[model samples]
Target: MDVIARAGRGMTRGQEFRTVVDGAWSADPAHRMRWEMSLAFVAASEAISLPVQAGLDIGDRTPMTAMLEAHFGCRFDTTSVDLDTEPLNVATRYPVVTAFEVIEHLYNPLHLLLQIRAALDPAPSSRLFLSTPARKPGFLQSPDHFHEMPRRSLEALLSRSGFEVVRCAEFGIRSPLFCLRGVRPLLRCIFEKIRIYELAARR
Candidate 1:
């Protein structure tokens, strides 16, 4: 097996952790847990429990790829596509996990979302793990953010492409002092149970 595949196997065997980074890591547990869950979900679904032919990390860049490699201890068969220069509408070697504050940076969120949707395997079990900033005060912290997306806009984009949003919820820490200030976890739990975010699955 190649390094990427071997690394994937190691991760599936519970030998190493996995992550995808878009920025420097914060000390916040909520932030860390959010990414951890996203990675674990993708890894478990494809690499661990089932056969994942290949995986794509769209917008593959230094920080994100570094995080993925460090945590997973594997070099995924990654594609570093920048939407401004090219399209990502091609078959990948495995399932995809586009995580850690990536979608908002895209110049064309819907276009890229469609590109990912097109690349999925026809099998209903194939999955994509996506994380984007929910509409909130801290969501616009980055100057590079092109869009401040709410649940409705994200759902519409995913629905139009043929993906059924299987899970969608905001996860973040708004204030360090007060635990009650965190609304993302509560909201996400509710959505996950009711299948509110599952609308983007292929339908």
Candidate 2:
């Protein structure tokens, strides 16, 4: 099956859902993931200049929704897409869409990107905001990420998925002193960064 081939083996709907929920999904910000969310919001604001009528948030019930609500003046909605199973069907197209820290968790991100492209509002100012953990040295990475894409690779995937890159930024989530914790932490301090992209659908 193309879904299996593209997504990876053994990622049946049941399997992927279990894997995702167990490790990646979160309901709300317990306190804050200050670095990640703030950075993504900044990128999103700069990406779409028009007033946001509504948004489709991919991972439902996460901090992304609230941060986006604030960014979009609390006018957003969520599709709560099960990236592997549910399609992004909606009565209205979203002017803004966000999937922060979500691509790495997915068994297949391309499918979701393609869906967002197809479902985006046709207005030229409509945009999608996606962020993923940057590819790091092996010692600095999570064991479970389905993809920690290099910047270029991510750009290429977006291009092929029918999005044109508006901008991309890379930054660390922690201070330099975060490395002082351990040898591995040192590697993480040097290599750990998040890449956020602002994209608009191709003409």
Candidate 3:
């Protein structure tokens, strides 16, 4: 793990905590969770328009980068931060950041959010788009999830991190497999049981 100074703050720290939440990018592409997240990625791509965007997830295995580049002509960066460091010390800033189903895997999600907020472009139009599991009674969240979040709690966290909740809602994903190609199905899935949050920096 590398130790480096955080951007702007100038505090030296070790590398981010290491973990592999979703490693099987190729072994089983038909998994329901993958499809659901893919739908979320598509929805986020369509809803947010930025010339450059960054993905903070661990691995760049999916076609999300390609899709965004092809559709929006956006430059995408999968490397801006060291994933082994705590609270995400970003090396660059961007107009938009996408962390799909990532916060739930963090032990200090709030800290990460704050860092992301700091790394944002700081314009009202700059945004952070993220998704995580919605906490529900008797719901079986993934084992990798460190903390499942309810909608209100998530909104509160965003507010505390200096972000305004533009849109935060729970959606259900029934047919995660077939919904990846079309927008309507993805939109329907977003309105179902899955949790998707689109937030804007307060600026």
Candidate with the greatest lDDT versus the true structure: 2
Segments of candidate 2 deviating more than 4 angstroms: 1-51
Q: Which of 2 and 3 is ahead in lDDT?
A: 2
User: Which candidate number maximizes TM-score?
Assistant: 2
Model 2 C-alpha lDDT versus the unseen true structure: 0.65
Model 1 lowest lDDT segment of ten: 5-14
Residue 27 of model 3 has an lDDT of 32
Ranking by TM-score: 2, 3, 1
Tens digit of per-residue lDDT, candidate 3, span 14-83:
3243233233532343335544565455565444554445544323334555554555456566543433
Clashing residue pair totals per candidate (backbone < 3 A):
17, 0, 11
User: TM-scores for all candidates?
Assistant: 0.59, 0.78, 0.64
RMSD of each: 9.9, 5.8, 8.2
Instruction: For model 3, give the RMSD to the true fold.
Output: 8.2
Question: How does each model score on lDDT?
Answer: 0.48, 0.65, 0.56
Residues 32-147 of candidate 1: C-alpha lDDT, one tens digit per residue:
55546555544544323333345555543433455555555555445444443356646553444453455666555666666666776555665666766566455323454556
Q: Candidate 2, residues 18-137: lDDT per residue as tens digits?
A: 234321334323214533554455655655764467887665444545666776674666544466666777778888877666677676678888888887999888888877778987
Which is the winner by TM-score between candidate 1 and candidate 3? Answer: 3
Better of 1 and 2 by TM-score: 2
